[model samples]
Target: MGKLGGEMKALAKHCGGSHKTVNDCIHIVQRFDHHLLALNVHIQRVAQIKVRHIESYIHERLAQGIGKRTLQNEMASLRAVLQQAGRKQVAEHEWLTNKSLGLAGASRSGTRQAITPEHYHHVLETARMKDPGLAAALELARLMGLRSQEAVQSVQWIWGMGTGVGGMWRRCMGKFDSWLRASSGWSRLPPFTVSERLGGGGKYQAALPSPLQSKPESDRTNVEINERTCPE
Candidate 1:
């Protein structure tokens, strides 16, 4: 059978209540079927995927004018699917060795300009006038140095006495910055979930512990609360 047929069988066997995981896995795997079929490469039996095969897939995408980032994700997804099937050394394939596909580091360039204080307020004002949730996301992105992708999906507000919380963030969907900056202590924020944040799903630990501020404790005595502040 062709690769699509094989994937179809996989999807069929994987569907239904007990097979939710299999269905999800198939969904992720099927995204590549269109491209694979176009190249006449069969995806049946992951063992057939020589490293050179993956290289050709990448080269084909580049030749057809696909962006490096999209191609990178495509390869990553394929690698994951194969690995999930218990195939080891997925990346060990010699053709797949050019890990980054000669592309520049994602964060090295093209990230949007960080919002300066002035621009930050402007964007906030605009977002408030148009959409408060979106404005709040802008604020979080600015204060937290989070990518826009990480900002919008934050729904609840987690406050602390001193240094703020930290975690992987993206897919910013709404605006809400509503905590008072009153005391000084690293705070443990609550956790929430959403669609994969490009790069998310770590252990959800306080992995990067917040550093306590250097300001004198005596001077930071008063507690000031503001209801007007948005939650981000």
Candidate 2:
């Protein structure tokens, strides 16, 4: 391995970086070598790396039909190597931003279309017919807006339910120890209303569900569950 490669491996080890990321960085560094030579610039001095070199590289890659995401990765590689070589200021230059690279909010492939109410119901009915278990998971997402992961993973029936001052309340956990509540109405419904448990250690209160389908809170009191994560 060259000095650049060795330094990169060391940086990855030091920072617990991913092997794939380190490999990508190394590839970018190699490309930069050829690019520097073509531009009649020295590759030896890390301190001599300028914004113009980076900008030129970006344009050259883009001209070759390289994608915004790929360019972004290459830029990240440049920053990593420069930062490791004590050229932190160069890496942090204002000209090196994602926006400057014309990659800010770049349209990505395979974007999902927004789900309509009719489509949602159709999916739910189909899912129910095929797999009740999957249908339950989907229903949790649809009614409560819990993330698919949160609905499937974080839910625990083992914790059991508790009777509160107002009604029966069961505390549920969401992503990152975010507690959700399952109350009386939740149990009565097909899928229990997923409530987010708020506050600190051992103290959690069931948050009131959001108004559903543009209906008033009072109107949907029977099924007062907040919509959280969007179901795919």
- The global C-alpha lDDT for each of the candidates, from Candidate 1 onward, is 0.48, 0.58
Q: What is the lDDT of candidate 2?
A: 0.58
Lowest lDDT 10-mer window, candidate 1? 167-176
lDDT of 2 by residue, 121-191 (tens): 89979997998667767766665655575456423432333333122223222221122344211332222
Return the top candidate by lDDT.
Answer: 2
CA lDDT of 104 in candidate 2?
78
- The positional error of residue 42 in candidate 1, measured at the CA in angstroms, is 4.5
Can you list the residue pairs that collide in candidate 2?
A: 144-227, 144-228, 145-228, 145-229, 146-229, 172-180, 179-197, 180-195, 180-197, 181-195
| Residues 121-220, model 1: lDDT tens digits | 7767888899866876665555444445545533322322223332112111122122222122111222223423334744122222222245565644
Error of 1 at 121 (Å): 1.6
TM-score of each: 0.45, 0.42
C-alpha root-mean-square deviation, each candidate: 13.6, 12.6
**Cα deviation of 137, candidate 2, in Å:** 33
By summed lDDT, which 10 consecutive residues of candidate 2 come out lowest?
Answer: 168-177
